[model samples]
Target: MAGSVRLIPSGFEFVDDVWGGIYRGGSYMLIGARKSGRTLMGLQFALEAAKQKEVCLYFTNMRPKDLMIQAASLNFDIQSYMNHNLIIVVRVAPPNDAYAVPNPDNYLIDYLRDIITVVEQYNPSRIIFDELTPYIGFRNIELLKDTFLNTLETIEERDVTSFFVVGEPATEKAQQIINAISQYVTGVFQLRKSQSKINNRFHGGNIIITPNVGHTEGQFNFKYRIEPFKGVTTAPDVDDVPSKYADIKNSLAAQQKTAPHYVYTQSKQDKNEREVFNNVYNYNDFLLILNNQIALYKSTGQTFNLVSVKLNAMAQTQGLISLNQLQNSVQLSTERKDKICIKDNVLMLLIVRSNPNSVVHFLSRLKSNLPSDDIDYVETVWENISILNIEVNQDIENAEELTEESLNKAHQDPGSYLPVNKFI
Candidate 1:
């Protein structure tokens, strides 16, 4: 995408004038201490972007109706705006919603998929994420990066802009997450509460964009206030630096540098007499295959094995070469010929109508490939691979039982591989 011809206003005149507002196709972050008006700033930007004719996707944990009411309180009236497609509010509550409603059986994966689905369906020009704290802690870092962050590359390719709202970190670990998250975004803004009162005359709080995304110079030092109907406003000022900034010093430096981004594509890799073949599908697409197979099992009672394999390589090129070789093995050896899926370390194969004997033949064929060769790393050979599940003939049962018992077993148990006997 070309450099942003125009910028999306943050609904704050001071910020718009200084930092050039938000650039199109860029990812930005808004983090603040508790009650520092972070959500308000996010909402204000969504309203302003919508008014400027940008299709804005507003994701909030609040109920759709409640969020609309909140926006209306700030004079945005997002309901009508939503009716006209100017702004859309989607409720993406994390695990906390399990108490108020019946959560999805597979909550985390389903929720992430829902997010990607909405982005694809709406094709919004601007996306405002109200709060990312629920998903960005130390333990949840991989979960967030592996799923949602990857979707962000597609969002950038679409030339859409985004602002992620994050909560202030009270602990050292949480602060570390803030540092890690800053590198991925174009820049970060630290918002804080002021010692003064919340009245209009006094500064409501302060905000500063670290490593300013625009041409603005010097360390950002601006105070913000909440007007009766105008929402949050900013003005140039100086005050105690936000504690959040101290922890993310190195992170800001990293964002200022250049980095290479890798984009993964889905394409046909091999062909047969009947049709072309996909070497591997992403995990999300593989879910469709899994669901279809389960549906077919309900109808025809056919059995299949869910196999997960790993390849050790030092670089991406070597990994791709090994993956292609593995694909060749599957095509030449296995009874079924279908597109397999690989993500991170695991490559998944759906072996159809296969028993233990057939699985052994497939393994033997893979072993027949002999010692592999790769200069970038040690010889790239199969490692820690096993048939994770065998959905064979069983008594008639409901789909729900199958989902929780058979389908998710492999997903939950990545290390459940057992020793395999010699295929020969």
Candidate 2:
């Protein structure tokens, strides 16, 4: 905790033993697949350090303004820190088309040299590279690797902590470059998704930290939720206005309409009021209502008979239903006496035979009912379902064990298993 580089005190928590030595002047690498929250976590670190009045410099080769806005929304106290010159963000734009850094010999070296100049001018305690993989292509991995190691050495000599972020989905050559850089860094952090033991289900993701000589590994996972402007804490949950209300407020302001008056005021009262009413009659709400109706039908074994019915209802709610006369727009039928049927505005499914395995399979398929774009969300929901299955299986095992024990007792006492039916 007394090291030159220390994690700032925040509600953020780490799991297991993943906090490798983050001492000041050390070089650290953060690697993850795209959208795995790598940049967000790095920005959070920089913001936390700035809160402590430590000079922190952030360099971005991607997403500069978006990162700053996200940091600001987290109630990072950016203004206060900026007033104290504790935080500085340096944006790096790829060279323009006319003057682009051509298929490179050492273009990135020039960029790093400029970055070093900025570091020297600021003399900050902490420095971060948002991502360097893009700037350095696959063919130039070794050169980038060497330059990165050399930069680390220089930062260490100056007692400045250096943090670098790398993303995946790059060429194999880029991965090789990262692998080489990984060797020289004092610490490496990798974030990845893994299957859960509960049921071979996948969870969000966890971070793994590897430390250099004389340091231990660190691991952590983030469980996030939106918090009011105050900050994240564990005292008690606060009743913040939902996102729908916020959107309505923005719409009202854009239209220059008066916001609805509320009985009580909260933070951003005008904004929340505008959003609340706008969402009530929105098209999105109508779609949700129709979707809910469809869900009810599917859940009650009416899917086969009502498939067309549900689709028509959905199309009607979405204003996509046509009034044109058509004889074959919908159809219905039964196959193998299974009570399957479908027609316009009607759908049904019959389960004449039921067993544990078949029921489980049916439920699993039903659970997969989500839009294609929401695959990740579906996966998460399935993971939860798998965990429930594990719990049920465990309970069944416990019941069988109890029944065995009862039978054994009956055999020993010659009367323990006597049936109540006999007495009746």
Candidate 3:
């Protein structure tokens, strides 16, 4: 077992309420359907754990290592630590490659040995198995079960706090896996794909905690949304960690400001006479508009890109330099019929008939036109600029697919922009 260590706060209200803080050697399960924010939540836990100066080992078969690092930068600057080797990411093959393809006969034992070897090598204080489903195959069920159970035993022996992610929460396989390993784990948190009765178009879900060893048992309904630069935020008003602005300015940088004064609507003749500007819509209206636009894309097959621009300087400086940059960006984009709106300090641009490539091009070009990227201004005001293609669909879980390609690009990398504190 690893040596005893000081306890650390998770920085999440729900987590703090549930367990106070993570147990030094506890094991947890995060079960959710695909795209249910499982990875997001797991990353949040891992990032907090790493920030405590504890060695953290993340085991994942889903997202690549680069993507995970890029996601972490949203909450706080972690590149220095990653460079120093405090956080370690372990990438392993999925079940098909690990079992069926490579070692036909010794699948379970081989993979089991590999996982055990990883833990033994790193001996990290925290271990996260992101989406364990890929490792637990249906073939040779009994042996695979034994392999998994043995791995759990090894984790317990190591006295390492662990997190396991399971996709397809509603499936019998998830249930079977849970029943088999639930006793060994300290707790289970499930994220589901559920719609709210209050708003039909908005996609969010409930998180249920089934008690086991170290945490209280309870359920909480939470909303989930992704910010272009911020990754996944459980709340609409705030993110899991501080926004980029917080890195340079005081805490006030994250406080919500008075809504910008703008006209609601106007007639065609009035629009021609006056400044024709679309009203900055609220989150609900943004969803409604996005839903309608998605439907339009389905019918027309026209490309539509959603670009979220955060005025990181909005709260820090009254000079409105960042706001002007946003306006100029919007003005340049509107030439192509791209409509813009503000929601939660982010200027959301609905680029009609433009592909992801063009959106990226425009934003990058517009960035050059902004005030010289001063180190202080860049840190406090100019944060990451990312554009994700919108695949207007009812399935929220699959929404990430829209940004899959962009996530791999060099410009989308976090190192290209300023890092910020976690928006707790």
Candidate 4:
């Protein structure tokens, strides 16, 4: 007899002492309040999978373009992935009665079928629904529950990992949706703010991961920061930082400077030195905060000239021209006169196009300054230029080899259509 097939664990896997672990294959849900990093966390998970060479599908019901820009701003390498067809992003408008009604039975079924079609086509290892709360708002609770269960069942059948982000409940109706989904989820990761017992001081939010039914629960505290790269850093160990830093009570007293009379009588010079030390301490703290924010932005996988170049390239690809085109466009005489330089980790193009109105005339000349690896980047810059405006006779067409329906059909019968190994 064949051995019984075993399902793999799909919970958090800690990478470092302070850095938070990752969620592997399984159906998981993230429940949190507004502005609580729900969408950001989903994006982080998708990015992590991408880094691991697993295809990711992101489905959004809100602010899809804004999310794309946010991802770009964080330096997520989205363009490179898009160019390679490694990631697929789709957006759907929220159902009209989804939030107002108790259940949207057929409507949700249709939506799920569409999603399933996409999944069958892409065969992504990871799928993320940015927020499911809006969908549950106006729909029937029972139907919503059944729909979620069906979705999970479909995912399990396909051996795909999934994540759903749900907002905090504003009413009993909302809570019901959360309760229903939580029952079927393979793991639940809850995010909530809490106060520290040791110092009686408020700390950051806590992340608690509860495995489904019989699995062990994992919990951790994480603080978001931006720096050399966008990623999570573990909270500093209590034993690592000086005890004085952790002692809020003593630290508050120190700020008040209400020590004994002997301390006050020490000297004016001593008091000045103490003031200097305090200033240094405050500055260091501020730097740490700024660094974290910067790191968070970096984690989005975008670069300084990312949006500008993409917009420009998209415009040119679409046959549009603007004032910005003159600067980025290369000209024959200018190419011979100016030099290309790589400074501060950025490629700079110096062009001396004399004719301001004829940016397209210099396209060939500018092409020389761009490296083969960066040609796509330059093309994207022109595409964005065309996207902005300025009509031209050039016929640019984008031919996609696959569609949602076809992709789904391929997945349903992989051996007959898709590559044999793709099913495995």
Best by lDDT: 1
Candidate 3, clashing residue pairs? 75-422, 240-423, 241-422, 241-423, 241-424, 242-422, 242-423
- Write candidate 1's Cα lDDT for 219-332 as tens digits: 576767776567777655434333343334333234323322212233222121112132345556577767677767778977676665544343335444455455545554
Residue lDDT tens for model 2, 180-285: 7788887677766433321332223555556663344333334322233422211211232223334433433333234232233333322221212111112233
TM-score for candidate 1, please give it: 0.51
Better of 1 and 4 by lDDT: 1
Error of 3 at 63 (Å): 5.2
- Which whole-number lDDT from 0 to 100 does residue 325 have in model 4? 35
| Candidate 3: stretches off by over 4 Å | 1-7, 62-73, 76-78, 97-105, 138-142, 169-171, 195-203, 216-424
| TM-score, cand. 4 vs. native | 0.49
Which runs of model 2 end up more than 4 angstroms from their true locations? 1-12, 15-21, 62-64, 95-103, 193-203, 217-424
> Whole-model lDDT, candidate 1?
0.61
lDDT of candidate 3 over 368-419, digit per residue (tens):
4444445675344445443333434444323234333233332345343223
For all candidates in order, the CA lDDT equals: 0.61, 0.47, 0.56, 0.48
| Model 4 / residue 398 / CA error / Å | 20
Superior candidate under lDDT, 1 versus 3? 1
Note the clash tally of each candidate.
Answer: 0, 22, 7, 50
